[model samples]
Target: MRLRPPTNMVDPRAKRYWMAGEAISNGVVTLVLGLLAFLIEPARPWLLLALGVALLIGIPYMIIMPIWRFRVHRWEITEDAVYTRSGWLWQEWRIAPMSRIQTVDTKRGPLEQAYRLSRVTVTTASAAGPLTIKGLDHEVAADLAEKLTEVTQANRGDAT
Candidate 1:
């Protein structure tokens, strides 16, 4: 029997980052709608309905998705490839072969840095281009980046 790679969830802090991002996006939409409701006197009531709908959708989404995504988002690195599983509802799994890996880059945005989180993106020769693993602790992300870089280099050298 062929065994698949085991899954590993991202850092818990990632939930905070996801929640913050979702909040900002929903807040912006709510703010813009609020402004329109106030400015357009005739459309005030209908826009208020829009505002209501936003709350109904945004509130539950903001609360549930971060937690749920945190639970489901996972990755596993084996000798041959890095396997990633992600999605809120429709889950996906992708395997990036170590031999085909072209680059391993780590990024830390302002918000992510504030939460001591970082993301690692692995670019491969395959058509998938790049696969990113988000919500890792900064140190973990850096170490993974370094390790993946070394492995890819060695794997490619062996091919020549």
Candidate 2:
């Protein structure tokens, strides 16, 4: 049987981090718009009604999308290559062979660091650019980076 990408999801805690981030961002946007609506509500009561409706719909979507993303994002390091799949509305899949990989970089932003999460970027010598796997547990990202480095070096006959 031939297996495909999206073999596994990000760490479970990743869902919480992603949801929290989404909620905060969306909440900010909603707040800004709501404030704007408040400024205009005296002139346009209908606009206030519209804004209320939009917020009612948008807030749920903002919360739901992170859960959907958590379900969708996945990655696996096979013996031959790395396989990744992620998207909510549109799906993206990436495959990077161990032999072609030049570097594996891991990064953590303030939010990610707070959540103990990191993103790993796998760069190859192709014009397609590097592939990034986000929201991994920090230790897992580090270990995966190390493993990928080993794989790349082994492919070059330098790991022994």
Candidate 3:
């Protein structure tokens, strides 16, 4: 059976947060290439070429990826499970059954903190690893984590 997209989209502010983070990381790579161009006299031309190429690719990636991801990224929680859809080029859809959930936590990195956003991570017994719902409002993520924790505790099972 085909799965439908999750019901809720991530916070709208996530787009700006994603773009800013990508720009910073891409900028760092470009900056390193530029510095190397200045430092190495013989390979200066090659380094500058690489820097130009980086800008050519990075600019579009910085702009387009966030927009695409904003449209794709979504999440939802029900009494039975938590659902999430994430990624731009390669999509991942995850469902963590309430009974299988081992832990639920919220996290905010420096960029997420700056954007006032948080991520909710749900760990399960499956070998696939934790499922993360990113770009949520900080308060919403906290509430989700707490609610999931409570539900998981009540539904404790091996899910075998």
Candidate 4:
């Protein structure tokens, strides 16, 4: 099915957090690889050069890719369910039917708090079936959690 945009689509502040984290992670990987190369094969300068090149290439990709992906990402809440589609290369689409949701949780970490963003995790009875929606505004994430809880409770009432 064609993806639908989120009703409350706003510019996610979490992009900066993600980019910063990505850069740090890539930098660490580059450092470790450089160290390993130096210790194991000090003669091979090419390995260190390759790692440097990867770091240089990766930083820009980390910055730009998220913006592009976020532009393409969509979330839709229909009468019966909520659907989310995201990612560039390995696109993923997830559907959380109201009936299947057992609980909805909202969380924010130090980075997320600094960026004023949060993540919403929806849990189901089925093992390995929970879904998380990340990079949402803190307030929006809380609201989504409340709505999901309400929907799930209402569905349970109907079933009984």
Candidate 5:
């Protein structure tokens, strides 16, 4: 299936941030491996060289795969429900009917703050069951949370 973001929702910086984060994380791993190789003498040179090459190859792989996979992430909003599709290993899709939504929360962390992004979490009646959608513009996240809350409340005739 060719999954795509909603036409009305656009996150132009998602891929850039995703790739940058992967690069930073991979750099850290490479640094740790380099240090370990330096401390161990027996295979030090070979290990260091191998790790250097691996880091070079892995960096592109890490950045490209996630961004490509995320390009396939999609969500659709209908009159009474929202549908989401995501996953690299075990692809799956979920539909959350407005009537079944108990609450919606918008969250942002330090990194997300730097990126000006936020995550929206939707809670349902199932115990401890919540769906989290991330990498959204902060304002859009808040608006989505508000819209979800309004829809849920309208369906139930009660505010949560």
Candidate 6:
């Protein structure tokens, strides 16, 4: 079936959240490489080279990925289904019909909580797995979960 972009974009603060998340992960890798470079004197040159290469890669990734993701990520919920588009390079689109949805849940990791953001998960019987709408405001995610739950329950079907 043909699909177009969803109607809503995720919260704008998600950009900062994504950057911070990538920064933390990249920071850890840099720290490890730096420590190894200092401690292993014989391999210092190679380690430094590795660190430089990592920075070259990580710096651009830290800058670009979040912006690209922000541009790509979108979600929309209607009376009949929930639609989402996500990912940066490897993009995905999903639609969960109310009749097929088995569960609706919201998730907030420590970082997401710090950013006051949440992810909404809609599980269906499809083998492809649950559909997620990430980077939503916490309150909005909760309301969306509730709305989806209500709609799915009202749909008269086995949710198969």
Error of 1 at 87 (Å): 1.0
The number of the candidate with the highest lDDT is 6
In the predicted model 6, the residue pairs found to clash are: none
Pitting candidate 2 against candidate 6, the one with the higher TM-score is 6
Model 2 lDDT tens row, 1-160: 6546567689887877887787777677677767877787565566666667877877787778778888888999989989988887897888877888888899998888889999999988877678899999998999999999888877764222
Candidates 2 and 3, the one with greater TM-score: 3
Query: Distance from true position, residue 125, model 1, in Å?
Result: 0.9
Q: Candidate order by lDDT, highest to lowest?
A: 6, 3, 1, 2, 4, 5
For residues 1-160, what per-residue lDDT tens digits would candidate 6 score against the true structure? 7788999999999999999998997899899999999899999999999999998999899999999999999999887888899999999998877789998889999999999999998899878889998899999999999988888878876788
Candidate 5 local lDDT, 80-138, one digit each (tens): 87777666556766677787888789887776777888878887777656777767888
lDDT of each: 0.86, 0.82, 0.91, 0.75, 0.73, 0.92
**Candidate 3 ranges beyond 4 A from true positions:** 158-160
Candidate 1 per-residue lDDT, tens place, 77-138, comes to 88888888778788777787788788899998999998999999998766655788989999
5 versus 6: better TM-score goes to: 6
Given candidate 1, what's the lDDT at residue 113? 94
TM-score of each: 0.90, 0.82, 0.94, 0.78, 0.79, 0.96
Question: Candidate 5, which segments miss by more than 4 Å at Cα?
Answer: 1-10, 49-57, 127-129, 157-160
Candidate 5 local distance difference test against the native: 0.73
Q: Give the TM-score comparing model 1 with the true structure, all chains together.
A: 0.90
lDDT of 3 by residue, 1-160 (tens): 9999999999999999999998998889988998898899999999999888888998999999999999999999998989999999999999877888888889999999999999999988888789999999998998888899888878746654
As a TM-score, model 5 comes out at 0.79
**CA-RMSD of model 4:** 3.1
Compare the candidates by TM-score and give the number of the best one.
6
Worst 10 residues of 3 by lDDT: 151-160
- Candidate 6 regions exceeding 4 Å error are none
Q: Give per-candidate clash totals.
A: 0, 0, 0, 0, 0, 0
